[model samples]
Target: MKGISILGATGSIGTQTLDVVRNSNDDFKLIGVTANSSVDKMKEIIKEFNPKYIGMMDADSAIKIKEFCLENNFKVQVYSGMEGLIKISTLDEIDIVVTSVVGMIGLKPTIAAIEAKKDIALANKETLVVAGELVMRKAREEGVRILPVDSEHGAIFQALQGNEIKDLKKIILTASGGPFRGKSKDFIKNVTLEEALNHPNWSMGSKITIDSATLMNKGLEVIEAHWLFDCNYESIQVLVHPQSIIHSMVEYRDASIIAQIGSPDMRLPIQYALNYPKRKEKVAKEIDFYEITSLTFEKPDIDTFKCLRLAFDAGKKGGLMPTVLNGANEVAVSLFLNKKIKFLDIADIIEDAMTIFEEYTHNDITIDNIIELDEKVRKYVINKKG
Candidate 1:
């Protein structure tokens, strides 16, 4: 059984990853888990998985876990803060680290996992969005397998199983278009947080749900696909597929399109990543073709959802620009989530930050550089909002 560590055990992807582990039939062992202040959920994971190590991004939560473990005689080690996260990620027993944590916070721990020679089941897009080159290079150097856990990237990985990179044409990422697919800017302007969070197809955390509503999730995925598949920005395409039956597709050089189709479930991708090079029993619900429906597609409304456009621009610009884009977006989304800004302002904030940092250049793409840039961008966004 392969030992596994989940870096965000309390989030949407993290819990789904746990389901994958739970159903692995002793093929995998849960070794370590980490979360950000979800003490109640973390308690449940500890009782069920009995992982050897636990990390809480929130210090008070870690103290609480320690107390709970002490009272219950759980005999598990608990750590706190970023150091704790890194420690869990690099545990000696963990052969694979499933990084489902959101935002730039995921970058450092993922790098630590790669450096520790642990194969990565990557669900965090911002890790790549901010430091794709560095992380990918580290994985290559350590001979670590950085598997894609996102549904779209997982589909692309599956479709390219037997194909050579040279035979590949372009990657097609499908977006469900969130809660406001066909709505105009006028309709989106006054949209409440609840309305934006009400995703039509997939259920996710607030940040990503907002990103989806703004079409920025697809944009981030575009950048992620570029890094994962080593494809050019121009070669990546996003189509609005409302049904979400097709997670994603890849077009070959000969114009043959291979699509990975299934129900809009995150578990499928999680299972795929966990069992790389092997296909286990199905853990996700299968799609029913008997319904006899049509799968339609449309171009993403980039003009209305300017975050998507900004992501593309940042990705193409390269260097620290994508870092700025992600960091700023994280802050903007947080502001919107807190009802401090309008939903449409997310793209505007990100764009303004990008514009401010456009001429910025970095000598090296180190973790320090990425983290510093991320901090700077976040501060800039908050100050601008203020």
Candidate 2:
């Protein structure tokens, strides 16, 4: 059995990943699990999986969990903070490290896992959005397998299985377009956080939900597609597919398109990544032909959801521009979620920060440089609200 570790055990993807693991118990083992501050949820996961180690980004939460473990005589090691996360990520028993944490926090642990010779099942888009160059290079150097856990990426990966890289023409990344897909700018202007967080197809965390509403999630996925598939920015295209039945597709030079169609469930992708080079029993429902009348696709309106356009611009520029875009968007989304900024202002803030960083910090592409730039961009965006 291949041992696996989950870095964001309490998260949406993390929880679903566990379900996949549970169903595939004969082939996989849960070696570790982690979360930020979800003590109760973490506790439940710990009891169920009985992982060897657990880490919490929140120090106090780790302490509470450790105390609970000690009192209950549960055999587990609890670690806290970034260093703890790195340690858990590098555990010898874990052959696969599922990086499910939402943002930049997942990057380092993922890199650590790669260095330790653990294959990565990557769900966090920010890890690629910020440091795709460095992360991809490191994975290549270590001969690590960086599997895509996101549904669209996973679909593209599956479609390219038997095909030659040279035969690939383009990747067709699909988006559900969120709950506000058909709404115009004026309609979106007054949209509340509730509406933005209410994703139409996928149940995700608040940050990703907001990103989907703004179409920035698709943008980051495009950048990620560039890194993962070694495709040109021009070749990775995003289409608004409202049905989300076709997770994603790839067009070949031979004029044939291969698509991975399934129910809009994250677990399918997670299971696919977990069992590489092998197809397992299905965890999600298969698409019902009778219930699905038709699948519709449309061009994403860059004018309305300008964050998508900004992401393309940044991805096209390369270097630290994508990092700046991601960092700034994280801050902007945080501000909007806190009711400190308007819904439409999210794109404006990201655009402004991207322009500034592209003009100034575009020269640095090193991991350290990107991390530093990430912090500065976040601070600049946050401090500007004053």
Q: Write the per-residue lDDT of candidate 2 for residues 33-100, one digit (tens) a residue.
A: 88999999998987887888989999999999999899988999999999878998899988999999
Q: Write the per-residue lDDT of candidate 1 for residues 214-291, one digit (tens) a residue.
A: 999999999999999999998999999999999999999999999999888899998988888999899988788988
Evaluate candidate 2 by giving its C-alpha RMSD to the native, one decimal.
0.9
Candidate 2 TM-score, true structure as reference:
0.98
Candidate 1 local lDDT, residue 315? 91
Among all windows of 10 consecutive residues in model 1, the one with the lowest summed lDDT is 358-367
Residue 71, model 2, lDDT: 92
Per-model TM-score versus the true fold? 0.99, 0.98
Clashing pairs in 2: none
Instruction: Assess candidate 1 and give its TM-score to the true structure.
Output: 0.99
